[model samples]
Target chain A: MYPKSIKDLIEDFSKLPGVGEKTAERFVLFLATQKEKDGILSFSSHLKEMTDKIVKCERCHMLTEDTICDICKSKERDTETLMVVSDSKDVFVFEKMKTYHGQYHVLDGVIDFSKGISPEDLNIDSLLKKVASYKEVIIATNGTVEGELTAKYLKALLSDFNLSITRLAYGLPVGSDLKYADELTLNKAVENRQKY
Target chain B: MYPKSIKDLIEDFSKLPGVGEKTAERFVLFLATQKEKDGILSFSSHLKEMTDKIVKCERCHMLTEDTICDICKSKERDTETLMVVSDSKDVFVFEKMKTYHGQYHVLDGVIDFSKGISPEDLNIDSLLKKVASYKEVIIATNGTVEGELTAKYLKALLSDFNLSITRLAYGLPVGSDLKYADELTLNKAVENRQKY
Candidate 1:
């Protein structure tokens, strides 16, 4: 129904995480009909640049152009505290907050039995080597089942490390209405009620 | 928040319709972290190929690799009936139905007054020349304000030509429930009700 190049582009676009065929078609059409004659060419060059330049940080497995990411190389960060997250994107989210001064260790993925992902598949070995020096290890993975499973596994593994291990607190989010909160969230909120 | 090349790629992705900063971030991350290392590079090369290959049909303004589109060059198509559409994507949609055998004239855009897009910005002059020989001209624009405006303006411009001009029927879509139909759609359905 579309030209060969357009169809091929749509196929490639569909390989992205959340893009479907319809959205891919729209994206390809936008590139094809864009008023800027050099837009698609520039976009192609940018993709090539990303492919040539981007690399993973050697120590933490986070995305960076250098061998070590800026967060890992920074001297201002709190070296005693380390946050363990499932993906590099989570590190970016935490960096946006600008509150946490701790270092990050990207696991690349979590323990998901359903998907056959396990501790060995993650960066747990490197984390074990690094954990002995940190005073605190915060498990900052998502609130999903895989995240909790990974945290539990890590806690048991790091029991002998003599460092305080903590997971992010569960409660109703700020600016959220109690009525709309799910039962589990409401329960967590009640259980973790603050001194205030 | 992201590396320079990643940020540049994200900015380019954000230019597409319906893509936002967050979605663009995800797309770049997907390309960066995909298991197939050559994925992003292949995608870049494909984009270059599209830039070099895709061209518009000389007669109808539809996208094609050659000087004339397949539909415009086909001898089996009904030359007597011409469908005027707002974009090439619309022509693809009609072709997918496998029912419409008429030739198409892509306006490339509609008469969007708010956006200052007039008939001159469209392929109206060529349409005026082609409508004379055709027995029927179907205004197959969208149901939006711009689409209707373009259809109305074309109707007046081609009124001098000796041909039957028709717009798509306004009614409840097939398989849609009357209870969920909006007031305007219900009104149009009632006014255009057929003899059952």
Candidate 2:
């Protein structure tokens, strides 16, 4: 058995989302080890800094240190187009491609009834208020049932705002086998085929 | 892009084993979220405590706050029987069974040539000094090639001393299928068959 402080550290680490007890122990051991002194110091300092400084963007609900996130404040991005997603991470995923020049709105929660994530818990109000500035609102939520439900709800909510509501088309992935495609996705792909 | 402090936190989280960039982002975001305030405080405090307080046991090289570990100082354990291991985690794995009342010696590392962990880097001198007091030494290092090399080297190191050196038997795990057993393990199991 370890000392009280180490035991508490391991317990706290295990409480993190993905780390289990064994992994938590390993992390603690690494922290206490002689080689990891510098790493531990830097990590702790960064964690403190992040918790103290990071705040949510007022318009899009994305995590940021400033009142508004970079994308929302940037003049380079297309303010007339907006992409709505479930989590802040999705904003990063879309940004990684360097293709989507539009702004983003992080819903932060989806309509997962089982998990108690209702439409009311999300930042949908800010989205509705912000949607008026954009000509097009793209529902780039996950391809799950909750995402579909959230998109439908958003579409209905923003219907009277005179903005074009578009959902990402369901199709086989870029390099997938047609034989392995799910029936629903295959059907949707066929239904939404273009002239080309 | 995220703010400076949050970005630094994500980088630190990503440095942890089994945690990727996306998972690190999720962890940092979770930390910044309103719901995780209490956990963040406790986690930081515990981390600080662990880094500041925890020290290695002088006798067996196990991590602890005291000069000697609880197991080493305990009068109830069999001081004559020493269990030698490559890491302190192995001590815990054996302890979890509630058996093995013998004393332990943590080598802390093995002959990891790839990582440049040689015998000199280990606590071998302390083990030799302490092993003389014990009649039997059980090498309970990991079942890896490095562990075997360490065991062989230890045997040679301790051959001049009057003690019975033994290695843990290689066999199918207690609840494992014989059909799924690997070739080396099966061979060892067959070679070291025990009488009922």
lDDT of each: 0.91, 0.84
Q: For model 2, which pairs clash?
A: none
Local accuracy of candidate 1 as per-residue lDDT tens digits, B1-196: 6889999999999998999999999999888887776878889988998888888898899999999999999999999999999999899889989999999999999988788888789988888876788999999999998888889999998889888999999999899988999999999999998899
Write candidate 2's Cα lDDT for A28-125 as tens digits. 77677756676677777777777778778898988787898889899999999999999887887788889999999999988999999898899887
- In candidate 2 the C-alpha lDDT for residue B111 amounts to 89
Model 2 residue runs over 4 Å out of place are: A115-117, B113-115
Evaluate candidate 1 and give its CAPRI docking class based on DockQ.
Answer: medium
Best by DockQ: 1
Per-residue lDDT for B74-130 in model 2, tens only? 999988999999887777778888789998899989988999999999999999887
Worst 10 residues of 2 chain B by lDDT: B33-42
True contacts kept of each: 0.87, 0.57
